[model samples]
Target: MARCETCGNDYDRTFEVHMEGKTHTFDSFECAIYELAPRCAHCSVPIVGHGVQKDDVLFCCNHCATAVGVHELRDRA
Candidate 1:
């Protein structure tokens, strides 16, 4: 059994996620996402998909990017 890093749960089915040369153990996907997902620069929501990036900042959508003064990003063609 392994211990979850997020909620401190110990379970036999715990899994490991590797990111940026680091390893994270979690009992469920929810905890993993909560710990690993990048937050939007504007609304502070977890980015689960291919989010927009302006310079070094990450935004969950074009609207969020625009809210933070990133006007060149578009959600659709």
Candidate 2:
């Protein structure tokens, strides 16, 4: 049984269907699309991931990921 990485819900017959590695799971195709979808740098709309790399850090997205400066979060650890 595959589980949703976000909601941590069991993919049962009540959800949408998708194939991953020969196994089938339920998670609403919309959710899957959202994961793959791009987002705005400032907002959270579907956009794209791009940015500059400093030191050895990587900015997943230029717009959304970089805008939020998630690198700070990564450095807190």
Name the top TM-score candidate. 1
Cα lDDT tens digits, model 1, 1-77, are 99999999989999999999999999999999899999999999999999999888999999999887899997777
| Candidate with best lDDT | 1
Weakest ten-residue segment in model 1 by summed lDDT: 68-77
lDDT of 2 at 32: 56
Residue pairs in steric clash, candidate 2? 38-47, 39-47, 41-63, 41-64, 49-61, 50-61, 50-62
RMSD of each: 1.0, 9.6
lDDT tens readout by residue for model 2, 1-77: 56765456776543444445443333665565566544443555653334334444444444334565554433222
Displacement of residue 76 (Cα, Å) in model 1 is 1.9
- In candidate 1 the C-alpha lDDT for residue 2 amounts to 96
TM-score of 1: 0.91
Per-model tally of clashing residue pairs: 0, 7
